[model samples]
Target: MKRISNLLIAFVAIEHILFLIMEMFLWQTPFVIQRFNMTEQIAKDSALLAMNQGLYNGFLAAGLIWSLLIRSYVEQAFKIKLFFLSCVVIAGIFGALTVKISILVIQALPALIGLVVVYLSKPQENYDVVI
Candidate 1:
């Protein structure tokens, strides 16, 4: 369960990294334009905003990676992961509401699942600490 949870977390982190790349560096590319279903004019108009959004995505990825690196302090690691995963879920939900519904499935769902898995994988005695 721990391994599975970690893998899911990693997957979410990687997805955000890709999002960072796409929104920041490739917002004007034909591939990104098609993937986002944006006209060239729209893409160009929104390039700066997309880059800012992408920087936030990069921060999310960084936080998740930081959580993964805290191996010695289990409780601290769990807390960090919970916070970042919750942020991802909330961000995804917001994006879905404001931008596109696909954001729910693509961004939130995996993090939600990962959150559950991570919670489940926690040691039974650690429940008190988490609460």
Candidate 2:
């Protein structure tokens, strides 16, 4: 379960990194414009805002990655994962409410699944020695 949770968390983190690249580096490109369903004019108009939003996504990705890297303490890791995943879920909900329903599916669903897996997983058992 922890493996699954970690994999899901990593997946979401990579996803956000990709989003950051597209929004920040490719915001005005035709492919990005098509992906976001924006007209050229609108994409140009909102390029700066998209870059800022992309930076926030980068932070989200960094937090999740940081959670994964802190392996020295099990309890601390669990807390970090929970906190960052919760943040993602909340942001996804807010984006869905204000921008698009797809945000709920694309952003929130994976984090929610990771949250549930982490919640139900037995963290201590992983370190138990069977003697």
Indicate the residue-level lDDT of 1 in model 2.
75
List, residue by residue over 1-131, the lDDT tens digit for candidate 2: 77898899999999899989988999999898888789999999999999999999999999999999999877778888888889999999999999889999999999898888877774764443121
What is candidate 1's lDDT per residue for 24-82, written digit by digit as tens? 99999999999889999999999999999999999999999999999998888888899
Best by lDDT: 1
lDDT measured at residue 28 in model 1 versus the true structure, 0 to 100: 100
| Sliding window of 10 residues with minimal summed lDDT for model 1 | 122-131
How high is each candidate's TM-score?
A: 0.94, 0.90
Off by over 4 Å in 2: 125-131
- lDDT score for candidate 1 against the true structure: 0.93
lDDT of 2: 0.88
Off by over 4 Å in 1: 126-131
lDDT of 1 at 32: 90
